[model samples]
Target: MSAFEPRPPFYLGIDLGGTNIKSGVVEDSGRPLSSVSIETQADLGPVVGVENLAEAGRLAVQQSGLKWDQIAAVGLGSPGTMDLSRGMLLEPPNLPGWNQLPIRDLLAAKLDKPTILQNDANAAAFGEYWAGAGRNTRSLVLFTLGTGVGCGIISDERIIEGRHSHGGECGHIIIQMENGRRCACGAYGHLEAYASATALVKRAHELLAEQSTRSSLREIPAEELTSRAINEAADAGDGLARRLMRETSYYLAVGAVTLMHTIDPDIVLFGGGMIAAGSTFLEDIRQHIQKMAFPTVAKGCKIEYAELGGDAGFIGAAGCARAAFGR
Candidate 1:
């Protein structure tokens, strides 16, 4: 290819999760050309994570029926703070031992293209903004309520990365005062401590242990219990399970109301595995936020389910790459 020759039209996006690595080859229009997923095996360490990500990108490109030179750039969504300028993972808590990994340089060297790295939640927000639920909005906020509560905020079509790239960390926002529960971040009464899936399971187990009433949960060992099981039990009208979801929704509402007052986003989108519990889960959350939030702010903002689902991160990563490279 000549120096001045235009590259073929394609971009690569990757979502590096704690359990799985998802990737896609996408076009400028944000339509995915092809996609793939694989186990993250993050316990193998940062080097392995990098290698797995690069390999996933390569496989996605090949599966998309594109030549190497056809690709314009690569985008990555990782679960932590990142130096967007340097493309490095900075002290990620989810992936232990992944401190300051040179992600941009490594991927650039391997893929022979420019690379952009964004926090996973931020990427998801951008994805929703560009092609999903937030397409028509100028500002939006996204919450991923899975293993933990992850948050992303976008304003004026830009993902707001605060000083140190930790701006959209609504999960760590303290909502409770005295007698608040401890958060995984070692703080007291953080929203994530009560709103996250892990927290739901923790609360369910605590409830089960405290009450003498027989629960379907007793049939399964506590070690094997999960948030999904609790949701299912709630669907079956189990009193304890229903109460667990109600309380979880209430705590989540606190955070949602806090975000509404702080950001005044046009819309709030929710994603993650826990959302699969369906409209009941969403309605409960909406009811609480509507009851608690200021009428003016709440009236202007709409809460909706995320449309892009798992692909949000990958698409957003690709969008980030496009934004970074001026594509």
Candidate 2:
């Protein structure tokens, strides 16, 4: 090899969730060269989950057609409170029956590569900041409204892992004043209780159960109701559906305003399945902020949908690996 020849290195990124473990190899240019996903089956055991991550990493690197040496290191994104200094997952609500898992050491041992771990939402935000929507700004907040609301904050190009590495739990912020909906964390009035996809479905159910409901959603079984269905119905002008959308959008905008006031981010981005509703949902959020927030605050911040799509987590994990390994 000539000394002047261009050299390219890659890092492996893994996203471990309750349902699936997604992995991919990202190039220096921030593109996912190859990807693989497998059932997490976390119910088996923590040991098995870590092993699955290692296997998934190997497969991703293999699919990238890169040898072990070509990949500098690995980054794993997990949902939960984490102590990066200790390389431990303190407590992940999504992955039940797991506690204080020393996943970094176990996965590094299994993959035989240096590794680092971060909250999955932070990883996604990092990916977006590095290569997606927030690429031009040094500070931004990403809110993912999925089964639960997950948030990641980046300030001055660094992920904010507060005093306990749990700083970015934006969803847990209080939205309702008193006697609001119960949240997954067993708290009342948290934004997660109203702005998340799960919350969207809950709102739909509540609307459908009311007497003399005229929405088409009444025809769908309660168990089959979903945020997507609600969005579709709202687009078709269903009264109940529009109510759910308006309510959720109100909460989400409040959350966004809160984030702007506190974090002072340059932009606020919304991700997860809820963004699938497109312009209408986005416009509603913007409208809420315009109406509810201080004019200066609303003018200072920009809100938009995340651009990395579904690959954000894994791609962000790769960015974390690059930073951790200095590759």
Candidate 3:
């Protein structure tokens, strides 16, 4: 049996995105005790981004009704390749000019508490494993389908951080080889090129332009079209929109099946804004995986929705910090 305390008073988790910063204080069981958010102002550059994130963390802890010293630690989730040992973010594509910033040390100095940093996808995977859909499962995979696809893999209750902490970057994994579309990452046939929310929007626009289709989506201005708008259209039974979603689902299923064959996880969880389209999106992907995955692996694994919603990255960051601090 384990000998850890039943719970801690509070811990801090921060989600640093290109557009916004969110932070929360959580009980040991993973429930949010308090939360706060602010604009990332990433255009202001890395210095401001770091300062804003640290300020968000401080505000979250203050709002949680706990003293600074009472909080155990802080965990931060960021986009980019991270050097876990050095606590540096190495040339993140989303945050231009943010090269080798010592995020962990900076945040720790600000808060006067230990801090740990991890890639957002990896943190989300751990969040799911610790307190979300992957709970009670020994191995799991999670994919966040947003502007781009982000993947997280947890095995034997441990988040897999391959050599150099670049493991589980499943979005970059090729699904269609040469015939596939070009990805934002400068690669052809990568899964995100077709399966991501941005890809869905692009496909929807292409479909609209190619046909005289009477989608409600067309009523909206072309510049206003988005994956969420298409999903709303799908919900309203727009055929063109439905077709776009189905195509996206098909490509996503192919990626999921590929991950299954490579990782053989016990469960696969899908989440992100795109998934708010609900079961139609999930069911289509499930159907494809059922048809394509190896029978043995398909039979043993289950597909489910991520329960943590947008908070998965924050919770996972906290869990990563706990792990880092040996708490």
In order, what lDDT does every prediction score?
A: 0.87, 0.88, 0.86
Off by over 4 Å in 1: 1-8
The lDDT, on a scale of 0 to 1, for candidate 3 is 0.86
Give the lowest summed-lDDT range of ten residues in model 3: 1-10
Give the winner by lDDT: 2 or 3.
Answer: 2
Worst 10 residues of 2 by lDDT: 1-10
In model 1, state the lDDT of residue 8.
47
Top candidate, metric TM-score: 2
Instruction: List clash counts for every candidate, in order.
Output: 0, 0, 0
- Write out the backbone clash pairs for model 3: none
TM-score of 2: 0.94
Those runs of model 3 whose alpha carbons end farther than 4 Å from true positions after fitting are 1-6
Candidate 2 Cα outliers beyond 4 Å, as residue runs: 1-7
Work out how many backbone clashes candidate 3 has.
0
Better candidate by TM-score, 2 or 3: 2
Higher-scoring candidate on lDDT, 1 or 2:
2
